[model samples]
Target: MTEHLYQPILDHFKNARILCVGDIMLDRFVYGSVDRVSPEAPVPVFHIKRDLLALGGAGNVVRNLASLGANVFFSSVIGQDESGRMLESLIGAEKTVRSRFLVDEHRHTTTKTRFIAQGQQMMRADQEQTHALTSVQESDLFSALKNEVESVDVVILSDYGKGVLTPNLIQDIIKHASELKKPVIIDPKGRHYEIYNGCTLLTPNHKELAQATGYPTTSDEEVSKAASILLERVSVQHLLVTRGAQGMALFSRDEGPVFIPSKALDVFDVSGAGDTVISVFAAALACNANLEVAAHLSNIAAGIVVAKVGTAVVKVSEIMDAIHRDMGEDTKETHLLTWDQARDKVMLWHQKGLKVGFTNGCFDVLHPGHLKLLNEAKSQCDRLVVAVNTDRSVSALKGPARPIHSEQDRSVMLSAFDCVDIVVAFDQDTPFELIQHLRPDVLVKGSDYTVDTVVGAKEVMGWGGSVYLVDLKQGYSTTSIVAKISSGSRN
Candidate 1:
């Protein structure tokens, strides 16, 4: 998707007022390092280094909404215990969220403590009660909802199968939210989908969707069939099934199912990824985004959270950056361009009044010196294009054994850096032809080369362009690194 399509939708999130109701809990993480096994048992003993506390379940949804710059009205139940007080304090600390937590004196607050070592979860311990709320508690919750539901742009029911989301309470919430014409988004749980009747959208993972529909959700066809069954039973208008690695599938009444592939590059932890998906989806809907746009934004948000370490919240800036990166990926061809494509791109930049800087190198083995040169080059202009020598050109310049990494790999690595805006591969030994065609505003080279020694200096200077020579870092060279490794191997 283009930035024009989603940037405004993201901007509208700041004005959205979300009503989040359902289970809330404290998520405590103990981070440590495991050195060796304990003598008392076979388990490894961890040396605790630090610990952190974060909102989990529905609270995580509120955290996510708030992080994305939304105004959230969070309603949930908690015990009159220490854990409950902590949870309350945590919610109160968030400036964008207003919380109304009912205190249940008869129960203990839900808390999940996870032990983490070396960036991996070792064990988890939970303390809580699962009994359904009493009639009086339900009445109080409904009363709170009535007060908050009228002003909210959307309602999100984050049910973790805890007592806060009883069948009766779910029905009441959906009915009341519907009366106010607010779209209700449910992060659903359990097999009983009827309780969530009339919800605008239901977000269930692969396992939950399969179990709820009594069918195997192994393929797109199968998932659509299962979702169709749930749509018949429940009054939900749309079903979004989150298939872990495969991404999400959206089934609606008016249109056929639309699948959005996962954008996650690295899956570290997926603890509260669902909360992120629902939070972004609801917020986008609240901002008047179409169903497909909302689903796409949610997919991006989910990708961000899963790459994090734990039950995490994504900020608006992170989402914006991800969108821009995705946009860049969509136009990957521009980054790795031919001479004609590079000329076209340079002309486009020139039309926009952007200064284009040109640099050339084999970039066989990227080191700190190369990064410093590129960074300095970028500082001299608005856009920096690095001309990478092809494998054959590098072999001619630096011998056959040089360029341990291929030209494609080098080009990709340079393109990944934010400082280098574009990468173009040149077959010639030097970038003389490439530079002449682009006619960049500035020509950059290392300090080792004087202006007269630079290959394209005369051509660039003839067009009122300047030449900049960046200082290189000492004691860092690709040639030296390769030689050092080779010597070590011989030794």
Candidate 2:
């Protein structure tokens, strides 16, 4: 999508009023490392590093909509417990959310706890009450729906199948909302698709679609077949199936399916990615964006979120940046590279008998010396990979006030140079992990570091790689530039 087309669609988000009704829960992520096997058992011993908390289930949908700059009206049921209070605080923290939560005294709040190590999920535990809502609770929810449905531009049913969206209430809400001429989108859960009779759209993953229709969805052809079967059998208007890495498929009664290839390059975690997809899709539809445009935006948003560490939110700026890069307009010959992406490129370079080069630094401010080093590094290899430190790592090394530019800005600056073939960012103090992963043929560094002092020199040498030290230009440094600026001297 072009910037001009996408920018206008995204701008519509600010003025959108969306009503989200369904389940809500707390998502907890526990991050740590496992090093040695336990003495008592054969399990790896996990050392806890930190814990992160976010909203999940339908609450996640609410968060995503608010993150995209929507004024959202959210209605859900939570247990009267500590987790419920935490969930309430999280909801209240959102600047643009108006929420109505009916406390269910008989059930505890739903919570999913995940353990992560080495950028991967180790295990997960879930706690919840999934029985259908009581009679009183269902009636109250329908009342809340009727009270808020007419005023919003769009209505979303985010069902986690936790009893809040009962069968009768689903029919009631859909029928009532349709009468008021408001569009409804559903992130459906469970296998019963018949109750969602008149929704504007239904979003289900491939597995969910197959489960609902009892048809195969392992391939594109199968997914289309399954989507067709479901749409034909049910009264739902349209279907959008998220096919994980294969991208997404959109199907309607009158038109053929439209398939969008996955935009994700490096997938770290897929938690809450569905919420992102539905949130963007509904917000776009509310603002008068067509189905295809909403699908593209949602796909891009999902790609951005999966590349992150945990259940994360996608901001407008990141989506804009991804769109810019997706258009092949980054630069003349530059594309940002992840560790896995750079390794794949190195493999191709090796296949063509080309030597791959690597260099590492914060590169906070580029000067004559930096250019000299890069030019010399490029002179000896066919492809050069510049691994820059992330903003956190830079703050740990330099002071917090240093690094005049952000990681993205720094990467763009380095990518603008002709000599830099690939630019990757690393959060560690040293680029040893990335270098060990890429295993470039030529490791380049400035003369300030000796053969013994370089981070990955030994590993490179072990793998038949050579380390070359470039001579630094005299009287030019990032420190000197910062000092000069601090002293009010430009010369």
Candidate 3:
């Protein structure tokens, strides 16, 4: 593919309009620090610290797509209740959201409150009504949906079995989307798999797939069979069966099921992971990504969401960063090339008195901390050259399953950054040779590392260059992101 081919795809995502229909829920997180045992009981007592409320379910899917720069329009049935008002307020405030909603007085809006203490989920309370919508409500929904379907690139049915997605409603949406030539993606729920027939794609977890198909997923073969059956039965173009740790399986009519491994390193809370997958897939498809590419990208997007807390959305930046990190971690070295080979172009760049900043790491999992460090490295110099350890090198330093994104992908992504002037793949135990050849004016590392301990600190200092420590962005690190996501808190 040409360098700019994917750029247009990403740009398309920035311009695509997506309509999200079905259930909308409010996700409320009650966060506290557990410091001591309770006086009344032996159990730990949590001291309340803060609380956060975010869009959940189908609403979260739109949030994720919106965060990734899509033109999002949300439509759903919400009760004429306080939580419904809250949902309206939140969705209305977003510039991209064009909502088509109905407020039913007979129902209460869905809201899930997760209480967390000491970075762990303590309990959860759910409030809402889940019943099939009346014919009148369904018709009203279809009327609004038909009007919006004509103008969008794709339609996402985010069903939490929360009443809005009746059989009639699903049928109408599928027919409308088909007529408009818009892809319809269903993030389905309950036992209503047949209701999602004629969808462009249906995304369900392994359990859901097994339940819907009456097949046990003991191995990849079984998973493939189930996915194929669902795809054929539902008359959908694609079937994505998400297997938690084993990753996802994609089954299409033209192509057999392809198993994609989970990209997530440390899974925290898997809340809304399916939403992340469907949103990414729909957005990628709307932007003209091939089904396989969309599936892979959405898999990576799920990896990002699972690595965070709460019902979180994955940004396009996060997806690109994941792709970059995967590339860096998968790089393989042919052999140790001589300085003549490795330093040919690099030597010229160094000789120009450019304040060449060098920062080297496995970057196995790129996070906000890494971004902050790279940005700081660039700020201290005219050009930033990021030296990433090769796959073998990372394995040696950080052990197995180290670098997530392969080295080539990482290099390509990092090179795309404005702050990153150049990217050099290194295979040695250290980037000593690259550093010695580049002789950077500033050697940058995270503040957690002292100047003396930085790998290339001494070399830079010996050549009259400065070894600087850039403090990590507070509360933003890969480890923290992982922990928070696992803990089911987004704060």
lDDT of each: 0.87, 0.87, 0.78
CA lDDT, candidate 2, residue 66: 89
The clash count of every prediction, one per candidate, is 0, 0, 19
Per-residue accuracy of model 1 over 192-271 as CA lDDT, tens digit each: 98888888999999999999989999898899899989898888899888998989999999899999899999886788
lDDT of 1 at 235: 87
**lDDT: worst 10-residue window of model 1:** 329-338
Q: Estimate each model's TM-score.
A: 0.67, 0.70, 0.65
List the candidate 1 regions with Cα displacement exceeding 4 Å: 36-43, 329-491
Model 2 C-alpha RMSD to native:
9.8
- Model 3: worst 10 consecutive residues (lDDT sum): 333-342
lDDT by residue (1-491, candidate 2, tens digit) is: 69999999898798989999988989986655678999999998887644557888898898889889999999999999988999999999999999989988888999998786665668989889878898888898788768788899989999988888988988889989999999899988888898898888999999999999899898989999999999987898799899999999999899989999999999866878999999999889988999999999999999988876445678776788889889876643334676756765665455344778999888999988999999999998999999999899988998989778888888999999999998999999899999888878789999999999999999887766799999989999888899999999987
Candidate 3 versus the native: TM-score? 0.65
User: Which pairs, if any, clash in model 2?
Assistant: none
Worst 10 residues of 2 by lDDT: 331-340
Per-residue error for 357 in candidate 3, Å, reads 30
C-alpha lDDT (0 to 100) for residue 109 of candidate 1: 88
lDDT of 1: 0.87
Off by over 4 Å in 2: 35-45, 118-120, 331-491
